[model samples]
Target: MWHLSRHCSGKHHFHAIALVTIHEPWGADRVGTSMSSHIEFRKLAAELDGPAFLPGEPGYDAECATYNLLTPLRPAIAVGAATVGDVRAAVRFAGDHKLAVAVRGGGHMQPYTAEGAVLITLDRLADVTVDGGRRTARVTGGARWEEVIDAASKEGLAPMSGSSTTVGAIGYVLGGGQSPIFGRPYGYASDHVTSFDIVTADGVLRTVSAGAEPELFAALRGGKGNFGVVTAMEIELFPVTSVLAGGIYFPGSATGEVLRAWRDWAATLPEQATTSVAVQRLPPVEELPEPLRGAHVVHLRYAYLGPAETGLELLAPMRAAAPALIDTIAEAPYKTAAVLHNDPVGAMPYQDRSLGLAGLPDKALDKLAELLGPGTPIPLTSVELRALGGALDRPPATPDSVPSRGLPFQFFGFAVGGDDLDELGRRLDRLFTAMRPWADPKHRRMLNFLSPEEALDPQSLREVYGAENYDRLLAVKRRFDPNTMFRMNHTLR
Candidate 1:
């Protein structure tokens, strides 16, 4: 147990009373007021059960490596927050010192770091509690989707999580999570959130939900981490133990034919099913299956929670369009659904762009073939198109900041991370231009999919949240964080 109190360390105006361990680099004899600040910092560190690493200290470098290899964090201090108390103390210290604070969970953000900010790595705080009887799961700030999946699977339940299990559950939901398999049926992961336990800028913890603090609840769901640092969230779950899910790989030779067939078939899909098509250029890595190794294949990924026979029958047209080089579609536990999308497990340089489409008309498919098909100038890893409709188009019972509900589909293209960031960004722009004809004029972009570059574009943010929701988000920001303390994530400021 920890409590915040004051102390006097030399000329320092304020300090905390707790166990202290000061690192060598931050010596007391340092010149200027920095010495006094360091003394107060040591006091704050004392309040934490875990050690806070100053620059050049052991474990400092390891704690700074967020998931995205491209983003590097250089903080004067990096704290490994082991508990809710630790997080609160770190925030309070940063507030007291006037230092910018950035929170890290799974650390999957495209450009995950904020230079010169005090980084709070939440890796050590993961603790998932599955209440199977109530069909809910309480996920801590640091818990990843994989942990939630593993725990919930024990009771034949599943959270409305995204394709990659490594993604942080709280961050994903805050950014409006889009599950490749469950999105069309479940709307979005944010809609299932029952409540959020957050520490605001003033170092006060508040439980935000529909009945209590209803306005904050609506904003928190898809507002990113602008108002506060979310420490835990209670999310509703579904009774889904297994699914008829997997990917069908076809040769590049049938790209157009197969995509066209899949598009037509997508029009007939039911709410129980969700599907996406991708043109993937798999590397000759030993980690991949033999059939997919060193192959450029057109993949049709499907997941259906209904009977296997009906699911297979619905997929027959795409299967018959061309001979599948590899078909992994079969009844399997929902826990293994990540194999369908198979997002890269290893850290590497990568860039991506996303846009919503009103419909995948012939013009759109032709553009995809031109830019992402074989022999295109861009060396893309995959150009994916996900079918969106059904529940996704309907308003959730609880209102949220998500504005992509009525879109018919969404497209994403990612390429190998390149040394020349500018050149890579320009090439990605070309892909967006090619699809602009069919792209939704509103140009809604999900926060989870926005790259660091896109996140800075005010026009992009305006289009993403729509005028009214964006205004509402700003209002909440003004109330809870007038100074914008939690501005690291995709921010309203």
Candidate 2:
């Protein structure tokens, strides 16, 4: 029996007494047990600082919700961890029950269906602390980029955040987070991580960094969730509060010209400038402004950390490449950086594919224009090519497992709609197949951009991480999680 007390405010307090029974270790197949198991589970739930849910429970579905509606999570047990102790408890419970562990932070991407696994949701643990003097931020497990951005903005500092501010900061870094605005200058977000407090398969909380447990540090940087649950991370911050950035929307008819010009012009820019162009077929939604609603356009996303004058000079070529339907390019605060990509918000059913490009020659540009440009009745909502090089092509001071280094470009395409998943999948496949000629021969790809389908193929995963990196990651997985207790994600097994 255990007594727990929680203070709602300075004035109010609540207490509860829970009777817990210690259950013997059970086989994985014995998850569906008798009524006694339910009583025992209820005791465990009462011990947690946050809520826990079982299948058919009132809040199970909501707790296991994912951003991609196509891949809904249906785990055997869902644990909402409000504290680091709760995380350890969940891990221990899963281990005792012979169940695999799956973790969700922002729930942006679910690589696999977590059926029968112990799914841990970290939304209740969100907390951000910033050290303005040291230019560092300590982001908790469930903290989003939006929170980090807001916290850092107060100190006139910013992190290398992704296009979507709603993305989980820790999960993003674990996947080698790439920032559209800061990537070219600062490299992947994982490169700047100073340390991570993680709960491994053994239910031990370990703080790994370059000096302590360097091997685990390297693996966790780009290895995704194969190792454990990261409770918190310390990341370096930049002094940038504003940037010369936004998008230039041109008529779809001009995609060919705009793409060709962007490819050539991008080659001449310095490391301070980052850019990408997307061919979009927007939906008729009220959320989108008048010009973009139900419109077909070529979006030129540009960002520069240098002087505004230099940014304007560099952008002159694309501005003159074709007649613009609407251009929102201008100087803006870093907090409004999402406007550049204008990634759609909220949950929607979608399928995506991505690949790295060795180069983007004129012929390759022409190929893309034909496949995704005007007159092709393509079903893809957006197909984008982000220029990768500069700091992104260079290695970090401390070597990590990020595999996309040296790639000149990254191509990502996705289709939105649930009514016809088969058609959406086929359309995405056709686009990738058509662009294979330009795809990187080594098959190196950005780990963060890897879709669920891409993550499913073992051979493809090996090729993406390269042979040496994958073998090294396997060794780490074996050492830490010998039982493969964390196989609910893109497993290295």
Candidate 3:
């Protein structure tokens, strides 16, 4: 067991922790403090021993490499927190030193300067422990959706996570997890979260849950990382041993026809099914293989909990609507669902914005078709629209935590595999702005999918969180994070 206490090495006032059993990097360090300021830091390192990466350390580059693939991010400090005690030391040191402490999970944030503050990397803490009987797992801040799914799958369960499971668990849940699948029947992934072991701005390790810190718990669900450093999170598991999951790809010739059919058919689908469409162009990578190598395809992915016979019955109309060049849709497990969206696993430039459309009206489809049809200037890989509502409309548990989700569809306009960040961002703005007319007034942009450029612009937040919820968030900031340490995740301040 690791015991957290206090110590001082010169002026540094870090938490002193002692560990009895664990790995070496995670064992107590009793020989590193030379000064009083660093004494506390050393003690804590000993208590909950883990790798402490100071400036010029060997693993520093890899630890801070979270945002290295895309955004221009440079942090004065990057500590690969080994344990909860390590997190406590870092928090205390930052608080005492009065440094802007920005915590990073996967560092997927565009620009990586949401609020222009000091950054902390937590990528090394990816440990997922599952309890099958209870159907729960304590996920690390660095844990990704893929890790959670793979682990839970071992126990014949799944967590409500995003399409790109590589997105950090804490960061995604805090921003309100809206996974591509499972949301229809199970609700958002946030609702399944049991608790959070967080290190707040004041350096106190607190556990927030439904019965524990209710208000903070409520706010933290969709609040993003505006309160503290979430070291670990306890989330519920879902039972899904197998599923009918795969993707349907339509050639560029059927854009208008296919979209119209999809728009019409999607309106009639039952809650047992979860499906979405993407208008995309496959990258010209030799390793990719076949028809998708260098062609524009309208991809449709479907996930049905029932058998193939029934799933085929439901998908008949969509299948009949268009002639697919690639029809890989078939019976598969949750493990195979990754092929449905063909999400980029190896990191590259990822920039996009999410839209909550009232519904895929004919006018909106026509607009999207016209803009992205065959010869469009927007070098986009995929423009997607996820089906929302059902459990999504109702708050998981805390009724007031999630603002009423009014829109029926959550749209994502994304461009990938390019280093041109500025160009990609501008293209997204054009698409979102063009969609303004059909986009719902109550439709809040999924903050996680928004571009950094759009992080500002006062009029936008009015549309996203709504004027009232936005005000509530501001009040939350005023109360809990007035100093703005947690404001690094796209804050207007």
Q: Candidate 2, 209: how far from true, in Å?
A: 0.5
lDDT of 3 by residue, 355-470 (tens): 77776777888888888888877758779888777677775666334543545877888766444556766887898788878776676666666654454433565457777777
Tell me the spans in candidate 2 whose CA falls farther than 4 Å from its real position: 1-30, 33-36, 107-111
Estimate, for each residue in 241-357, the C-alpha lDDT of model 1 and write its tens digit.
Answer: 888888888987677888889899999999989999989888777666777777888989898878999999988888898999888898888878745677766665656788888
List model 2 lDDT by residue over 152-231, tens digit each.
99999999989778778898898898898889988999999999999999999999999999999999999998898899
**What's model 1's TM-score?**
0.90
By descending lDDT, how would the candidates be arranged?
2, 1, 3
Instruction: Choose 2 or 3, whichever is better by lDDT.
Output: 2
> Each model's TM-score, in the order given?
0.90, 0.93, 0.85
The lowest-lDDT stretch of 10 consecutive residues in candidate 2 is: 12-21
